[model samples]
Target: MKRAFIPPADSLIAFECAARHLSFTRAAEELHLTQGAVSKQVRQLEDRLGVELFRRVRQRIVLTDAGRLYLHDIRGALENMTAATRQVMSYAGSADVLNLAVLPTFGTRWLAPRLAGFQKRFPDAGLNLSVRLQPFDFDEEPFDGAIHHGDPVWAGAIAERLFDEEVIPVASRAFRDRHDIRDPADLVRVPRLQLATRPLAWRQWFEHVGVETDAAFQGARFEQFVMISEAAIHNMGAALIPRFFVEAELASGRLVQLFDISLDQNTAYYFVYPEGRTMRPVVKTFRQWLMEEARTARTNREAMLPR
Candidate 1:
C-alpha cells in the first residue's frame, strides 16, 4: 500500500512565513514565536523532506530552487484554505457569498455606481470583488464569475453580453488648441496614446475614419484605459478611449472629443461564469439583475442620442 504524505501544519506555516520574509527573525516576529523556535521548525521540516530549502550567503537567507517551487504551492494552498474558511463561515451564518472578478476601470466607473441597487435587492448576499485586468482560467480560480471586456471568448464559460463598446478619440482641450487639430487627418501630427492590449487601436480608428497615417502605430503605450485617460487629461497625447469610461472627464470638460467618429471594434463586455457549474442562488439573481440593468442602460443611451 502506498503511504500518503502530509507535512505538519505548523511546520508548513513556519516554512511559508520564513520563505516569504527570507528571515526567520521576521517570520518569528509576525508569528509571535521566538526566532530560535522558527529556525528550529524550519530545520525539522527540511530534515524530513531531505532538502536544503534555504542557503545563507553573507548572513542573508535566500531560497533554493526547491524552496521557491514549494513556496508557490504553499501560498496557493494557504489562499485556498482561507477562502474556504470564509465561505464556510458565511454559510454557517446564513449568508450568501459570491466571489467575482472584474476589470478594474469598468468596475470603478460603471458597475460600482450601480452596486447599490444590487445591495438593496439582496442585502444578505456578500459580494467579494477582485480586480482581474485580463481573462484567466475559470477552473483554476475560485471566482464564481467575472465581468470581462473585449470579447465573449473565454473558454469553459457562458458569456452574457453586457453592452457593446464604442470608442472615440479624446484629448485635453489644451492639446487640441495647441495642435490646432480641426479634422481627423490632423490627428497624425500629434502623439497618440496606445493601450498595450489593443496595439492596433489607433490604426483601426484611422482605418474606420478613412484616413491614413504612419503615426497610428506610434506613441506611449499603457496597460489600462485609466492610465490612457490620465495621459490624455494631462495633454500627453490623444487616446482612443471607450466612451463610457471617459464620460465623467468629458462631462467635466477635462477631455474633449476630437472628432464625432466612433469605432465599433466588434467587441463587447460580458458577465461570464463556468458553464457546467451549478449556479448559486445569489449568482443567479445577480446575473438576471445585471442583464436587466444592461438593457436599461442601452435604452437610455439610445434615447439620448440624436435621431
Candidate 2:
C-alpha cells in the first residue's frame, strides 16, 4: 500500500476522538477547542482522504464504512505517536525520574500499593511504571531499573535479589463442590487451567504432591494470571497461580485450596538496573523502598499461613 500523505497530528487526533464518540462537539470539548475548529480538522482529514467519511444526518454525525476503517487505522497510529512523544518527553531531563519495568500482575497487586509511600519519601522523584512481558535488552531501553523475575544474571545490569516465589493449587468453592477432587491426584481428571505467564507452574505443583501427570500441559491457557484465576472461579478448571493474586478469593470463600501442595519457584524477584546505574538517586530510592515492601510482604504471607 502506498503511504498516503497523512493529515496533521492535531487533525488526526480530533478525527479519532470524534469518530470514537461519534460526536464532533464532544471531541471539541475534549480537545479544548471550538466546535468550528474540530469541524475544520475533520474536513481537512476527509479532504486528505478524498472520501466522504461521515454522514451528516438531521443533527448528528454517523460514520460510513470507510470512515470506520480509516478511524481504526488512524487511531492506532495516533496512539503510537502519542506514546512515543510522551516517552521522549519523559526521558528529556532529570535523573530523579525512576522508570521501572515490572511484571504486569505483580506490579498491580504487590508493587503499586506501596508506591505512595515511596512517593512520600522521595517527593521530588517521579516514579514511572513500564510493563516487562519478557526479558529484553535493558540497556537498549530507556528504563532506569527493572523488577524482573528469575536470578541476577541479566546482562549489562546489576541485579539484586528481592524475594522468592510460590504457587498453590486453587479453585472456586463452587467448582470444588461440583468436582470430586478429594486428592491432589484427582486434579488430573479435571480441567487443569494453565497460565501462560508461568509455563512450569503445574509441573512444580504436581512434583510437590508426588504426582506424575503429563496432562498438566492440557487445559485452557491464558496469558494473564488474573484471567486464569477468574476462569478457575467460574469452574472452568483448577489453576495453580501465585498466592498473592488470589488472597481475596481465598479469604472470601470465592476460591479454595485444592491441596496443601506449595512449590517454590526458587528464582526470586530481582531489582535490576543498567550496569553503570548503581549511584542513581531515583533508582537507589526505588530499590530501597521495594526491598522494604518485599520484607513486609514476606512477613504478612508467613503470618497468614496455618500454624
Candidate 3:
C-alpha cells in the first residue's frame, strides 16, 4: 500500500498548540514564533490532513467538530509524551532518589508503620533506606538525610528535633514474678538486658529514683532496642526501653513495666541533613513529612501510656 509522505513535524506541533490554546497569537507566543508563522504552519498541517482545523471569523477563531476532536486526542497524547520525557530526564539526572538512614529499631518499630503516607505524598520519588549504627560521614555514605538519636547535634549536618526518647524499665510477666520489684532498689536483684548504644541507661534511671546499683553494667548487651525489648518479652531479663517503642506489647501483656519509674534521656532523636543542604527541595520535603510522622507517633504513644 502506497501513501503520501507526512509534512514537517513542526507543522503538527504548531497545529496542536494553536488548537489547544484556541488562539494563533497565544500559540505563536508559546512556540516563540510570530502569529503569521504559526498560522502558516497550522494551515500547512490542515492541508496535509485534508481538513479544516480552525474556522476564522472577524476578531476570533474557533475549532470545527473534527478540529475539536483532533485537539482533544492530540493534546492528551502530547501531554503524556511530555510527562514521560520529563520522567526519563529526571531519572537520568539521578534527581528522583531519596536516600535515607535511620536507626534499626526505630526504623522497624516506629518509622516503618508511618511510611505509607510518605509513599502517598511522593509517589514518583524513589525512597531508599539504610540502617545507621552511629553518626558518621554523610558524604562518605552518599545519604541524602538521616534519622539520629541524640542532642540534635550531629556535626556538619542540619538537625531537626523529631522526638524525645524516655526509657522505663520493663520485664516479662515471669521475670517480674520471680523477682519482687516493688521499689527501684529491687532492680539490683534482676538480670538487666542492656542496650550497647546507651550504656548508662540503668545508672540514669536509678539516679532519678535516688537509688544506686553496681550491677548496672552487668547484663546482656544488645546493639538495638528491639532486641533488648524482645529479649525481655521472652523472659530473658528486664530492659530499659523507650516507652513509646513497646506500648503495644505492654498493653497486650506481652511485656510489663516493673515500676512506674521513667527517666528522660538528655539526648533525643532528630532528622539530620547535610549542613548546607537542608534547603534543597527534596530534603525539605522529606523533613516535613518525617516530622509529621514523628508527631503522629508521639501522639499515639502518649495515648497508649498508662496514667
Q: TM-score of each candidate?
A: 0.87, 0.71, 0.65
Q: Which whole-number lDDT from 0 to 100 does residue 225 have in model 2?
A: 83
Better TM-score candidate (2, 3): 2
- Clash statistics: count for each candidate: 0, 0, 0
Better of 1 and 2 by lDDT: 1
The regions of model 2 sitting more than 4 angstroms off are 1-81, 88-95, 303-307
Deviation in angstroms for 194 in model 1?
Answer: 0.3
TM match of model 1 to true structure: 0.87
Candidate 1 backbone clash number:
0
Q: Global CA lDDT of candidate 3, please?
A: 0.83
lDDT against the true structure, per candidate, is 0.89, 0.83, 0.83
lDDT of 3 by residue, 77-121 (tens): 678778657544555544576778988888898888778887777
